[model samples]
Target: MHIAVILKQVPDLVEEVEVDSQGTDIDRDSVKWKLNEFDDHALEQAVLLKESSGAEVTAVALAADGVDQLLYAAVARGVDRAIRVTTASARTDAPAAAAALAGVLADMGVDLVLTGVQAVDDLHGQLAPILATRLGWPHVSVVSRVSLEGTEAEVTQEYSGGRMATLEVDLPAVLGVQAAPRPPRYVPISRLRQVMASAELGSAAAAAAAPALGSTVTRLAAPPQGQGAQMLEGRPEAVAEQIVALLRERGLVEA
Candidate 1:
């Protein structure tokens, strides 16, 4: 079987975020980019499948700064192929990304497509469902595990309240992976460097343009700071009395 994993780059959250001059997006130029954490799990699931079932795994991503290194790391982690799509856009634009990827993936002949269930940057919509809609393929979200037998795939979906359901789908389906069955393995930086030197990533032109969403961001600003936390250092009874008095002041309790 052939599996294709979708990878995305996200801004490292450790850095301070600044709004762009347009007031519609973050200042991408000011931040460093890294692989999406959820996508890392998706890649790990794909690699696990490749190891267990002898499936061919392909990692696909859009061209961006540090994306080549991400692809090389995927190679070191057991991806058989890597393809970079030629396009430029703010990573938050999920609709455009889904449209572009759907067009390109149409001709790949892959049996399964795996993507993260959600991304920190993609607040518009998750990519996997939208991509599946564009491709007219079956899609399942919040999938935690996947296993294949013949032309059918069994997947475990996690739901709220600590619930899980297993379902089976025929081949040529897309899954929004919440997690892999196991934690993602670590690849040595030296191995990644070697792959970077030896591996060549395939490139493809985006076959479709991103469609416009029906809305626009007119303004962006940081949230206003609130009063800092109050420390309660007293006896248990005193603390309880203080908490009840505070709640009463806020009308949270009957005074």
Candidate 2:
């Protein structure tokens, strides 16, 4: 079986984020990027399948800052191929990403596709469904486990409150992977460096124009800071009276 794992880089939250001058996005120039954590899990699942079932795995990502290194790392982790989709802008809405990916992936004739359930940048968690819609393929999200069987795939879907369900999806489906069965494996820095020097990444241009479904951000700003807590000292009776007085002052209780 052939599996295509979609990848994306997101701002490393450890680094402080600054708003760009445009007020609609973060300052890209000041940010350090890393592979989206969920995407890492998706890659792990693909690699696991490759190891267990002898499946061919392809890692695809948009051309962006540090993307070449990320693809090389995937190569070190057992991916068979890496492709970078060339786009006018690295930062795109989910619809645009899905459109570009679906166009290239459709021609590859992959048996299955996997991606993170959501990107930290957008958190829409809609890329899989959108890509599936564009490609006219079946799709499922919040998948935690996947196993291949002939032309179909069985997956464990996770729901809210720690609920899970097993589903069988026909081949040529897309899945939003919430996690792999196991934690993502580690690749040594030496191995990654070697792959970076030797591996070649295929490239493709962005597909047709993105639809008009995306929204325009008008403004962006930090949330307003609020007054900090006021400590209530003294006896329990005094604290209770203070609380009642404060609530009354705020119109939260009968005067």
Candidate 3:
């Protein structure tokens, strides 16, 4: 079986975020990019499946700063192939990115497409479903585990309220992975360097253009700070008395 894993590079949250002059977007040029955490889990899932079933795994990513390193890193971790798509614009919303990826996935004979349920930057959780729609393939989201037999796949998905549903999906399906069966193995820097120096990388042209989303951001601002915490320090009895008084003062308790 051939599987394609869509990888994304997202800005590390530790980096300071600043809105661009347009006020609708972030200033990408100033941000430090790293592999998206959820995508990291997705990659591990693909590698695990590949190891267990001898499936061919291809890691695909859009062209971007530090993407070559990410691809090489994947190769070092045992993915069989790496592909980088050429894209003109960096403003890839979930639908636009899915559209661009659809073109490349169509010709790759991808029996399974696995990616993160949501990117840290966008957190919209829209890419997998949209890509499946574009490909006319069945899709499952928030999938925690996947098992394959012959041409059928069984996936266990987690939902709100601690619920889970296991679905039997046919081949040529898409899954948005929420977690991997195991954590991703660490790849040494030397291994990554070896792949970067010698491993082959493939290139493809994405959809000619991305359609614009219907919405726009007018203003961007940080969330308002919450009320600061109050400290009660004393002997146990005194602290307890203070807490009771404060709660009664705030009408949280009947005096």
Candidate 4:
């Protein structure tokens, strides 16, 4: 089986974030970059599937410069090969990103594409579905488990209210891996170094074919400052009355 796992390089949560002088982009110099946390689980799943079924795993990333660290990390984690699609644009819009990925997958003849439910930075959670649509493949989102048998694959999906539904999908499918499915394996430093030194890393030059399929983002702004807290005084009943009144005023409770 040939499995393709999509990965993204994102700003490390541990590093402090700063907006650029123009306020339209982040300060790249100050931020430390790493693989999107959820993508790590997706990569782990790919590796596990390869180990159990003797499948070949290919890890792909669409990123700008300075993403070698993230790609090296994926290699260390057991991905058989790595491909980087370099984009000059700093914008991380989901549709445009998905279109680029679809192009790459088209060239690679991917049989299965696995990705995280969402990336931490943008948190759009749209890539897998968008890519599936673009590629004309069956898509299953929030999938917790997947098992391949013969030409079909069984997927366990998590739905609302903690419910799960098992589905059987044919080959050439896309799945959005949910966080609750399974814990990703840890990559030891020794293996990391070995893979970093030995893995075949390749890059695809940015496509100049046409303008991005779609673009949006009229304006960007920071979140509003939080308000100061207020203390509730008096007896429990009195405080309850105040809370109810506040809730009613805010339209959270019918009065």
User: TM-score, each model?
Assistant: 0.87, 0.86, 0.87, 0.79
Model 2 bad stretches (over 4 Å): 123-125, 227-255
Against the true structure, candidate 1 has what lDDT? 0.89
Candidate 3 lDDT over 1-255, as tens digits, reads: 999999988878898988788876778888888888878888999999998899999999988778988999999999999999988777567877887899899889899999998886563337899899989999999999988899988999998999999899998999999999888899999988888889999999885577767666777767677867777899999999998988999999898
Summarize candidate 2's per-residue lDDT along 74-150 as a digit string, tens digits: 99999999999987654566787887888888878899999998887763336889999888899999999999999
Off by over 4 Å in 4: 88-91, 123-125, 205-219, 226-255
Tell me, what's the RMSD of every candidate? 4.7, 6.2, 4.3, 5.9
Cα error of candidate 1 at position 12, Å: 1.3
Query: lDDT of each prediction vs. the true structure?
Result: 0.89, 0.89, 0.88, 0.78
Worst 10 residues of 1 by lDDT: 86-95
Clashing pairs in 3: none
lDDT of 1 by residue, 35-150 (tens): 88889999999999999999999999988778888898899999999998887654447788887788778778889999999888776889988988888999999999999999
Candidate 3 stretches with Cα past 4 Å from truth are: 123-125, 226-255
| lDDT score, candidate 2, position 196 | 84
Regions of model 1 farther than 4 Å from truth:
88-92, 231-255
Clashing pairs in 2: none
| lDDT of candidate 1 at residue 34, scale 0 to 100 | 80
- TM-score of model number 4: 0.79
